[model samples]
Target: MKNHVLRPLWVAILLVIALLVARKLYVPADFGINGRNFTYGYYRKASVNDWKEFKVKYKGRQYCKECHEENFDSISKSKHRIIQCENCHGPAIDHPDNPEALEIDRSRGLCLRCHADLPYPGSHRNDLPAIDPEEHNPDKACADCHNPHKPDLEG
Candidate 1:
C-alpha cells in the first residue's frame, strides 16, 4: 500500500508475466481444444492436416453436373438458381479444358456485385433484382441484356 499501490501492483505483475511469455513464444503446438469433434472451431492440430492438403478449389454444383449438362440444365432452371457455375465462371479449377483458365467475369463491376440500385431497408439484399447502375445499360454487358443462364431470357 505505498509507492502508489506498489507501483501499480508491480505493473500488473509484469504485465501478466509478459503475456505468459508471449503466449509461450507465439502460440503454436497444435493451438488447443479443436479435437474430438470440435472440427474447425478452435484449430491448428496441423489445421486438420492443412485442410486435408488443400487443393479443393471449388468443385461444387455437383462438379458442374459433370461437364456443363447444358449449362447445368440452364443453371438449374434460371433466375440463376442460387447462383454457382463457379460464381461468374472463375474457378472451375483450370476450367473448360482450359478456356484460357476460364475467367468469364465480363465486368460491369461483376454485374454491380448483385445489381446496384441498393435500397437496403431491411435487406435480403433488397430481394436481388436491382439495377440502375447508371440507368441500366451502363454501356452494355449484364451478359449484354441478361442471359445469365436464362435469367428471364431476352439476350
Candidate 2:
C-alpha cells in the first residue's frame, strides 16, 4: 500500500497493541473468563462473595404474611394478589424482625403507578382498572376512598 494508507494502518495496529498491554496491567487478576463454564462466560469470581454480603431491601410477600396474616389474606384474595406488598409499602428491610412497621406509601402517585388511565387501542393494560387521576377526586388520596386490600369496595 501507499505511505498514506500504510501510515494509518501502522498507527491502528500500534493502538490495538497498546490497548492489549494497558488492559493486562489495568484489569484485576480475578476478573476474566475462568473457563467456558464460568458464570456468563466472563465474570469476576469475587462477586459471589460480594452478593452474599449484600443486604436485600425487599422481603417477599410471605415475609409480611408471617405477622400480618389478616391483611395478607385480604390482599391474597383481592386482585392485588399479583402485586407484592413491598411494591407500595416500600422495602421491608427489617420489619417484625426489628419490630418496626413497614413504611406504607399512601400517596395517590403510588396507586397511579398501576391505576393511571392511559388505555391505548389493542393493549393488555385494559385488564387493570384505569381511572382519571385529576377527574377522580384531585384533592383526596385513593386509599382514603378505596381500601387497597379490597380495592373494588368503597371506604
Candidate 3:
C-alpha cells in the first residue's frame, strides 16, 4: 500500500522536474529580463528580423507637406487643419521613391465616423457639425458637396 502511493508521487515529481527542464531549455534566454514579460521576450526573439525590417508607413503630416505643399497649405487654413494627411489617404511609405498617388478613401462610412449625429449629449466637439447621414443626404457622399481639404459645404 505504501509503495503504491509512493510510486505515483515519485512519477508526479519527475514529471514536474521534466517540465521545468524543458522550459529552461526551450524558453528564450532573455525571458523576463529587465522587467519585461515572458510574452514580450518570446515574440521579440521570434520576430527579431521582422522588427528590424519594419518600416514606418505613416510618415506624418510634415512628410506629406514636403511633396504636397499646396494641399498642406490649404488644409492648414481649413477646418480640417487638425486632421493628418494619412488619416484620409493611406500611409505614404514608399510614396517618395515610388511616386504613386495614394488611393483616397472616399467611403461615406469613413466620413460618418466623425460627422454622424449621436444622441448622447456632448459626445462630439462643439465645433464639429454632426448630421444624420440617412436624413442629411441619403444618396450623396460628403465629398459631393464638401471639399475634404477645406471641408466646409457652404464655403
lDDT of 3 by residue, 37-88 (tens): 6655334454567788888888999988987899999999998898899988
lDDT of 1 at 22: 96
Name the regions of candidate 3 deviating beyond 4 angstroms.
Answer: 1-53, 125-127
Model 2 lDDT tens row, 1-155: 66897899999999999999999999988887777666567878888889999999888989888888998998888888899989988799977666566778889999898789987778777677998988999999887778898888742
lDDT of 2 at 119: 76
- List where candidate 2 sits over 4 angstroms from the true fold: 1-32, 36-43, 97-101
Clashes of each: 0, 0, 0
Give the Cα-based TM-score of candidate 2 against the true structure: 0.70
Among the numbered candidates, top TM-score falls to 2
Number of the candidate with higher lDDT, 1 or 3? 3
lDDT of each: 0.79, 0.85, 0.81
What is candidate 3's TM-score against the reference? 0.66
TM agreement with the true structure for every prediction: 0.25, 0.70, 0.66
lDDT of 1 by residue, 1-155 (tens): 56887898999999999999999999998778754555656766786887889897777788878867887987777777788878888788867677698777878897788878789899887988788889877778777767778877553
Residue 67 C-alpha lDDT in model 1: 68
Q: Order the candidates by TM-score, highest first.
A: 2, 3, 1
Q: Which candidate would rank higher by lDDT, 1 or 2?
A: 2
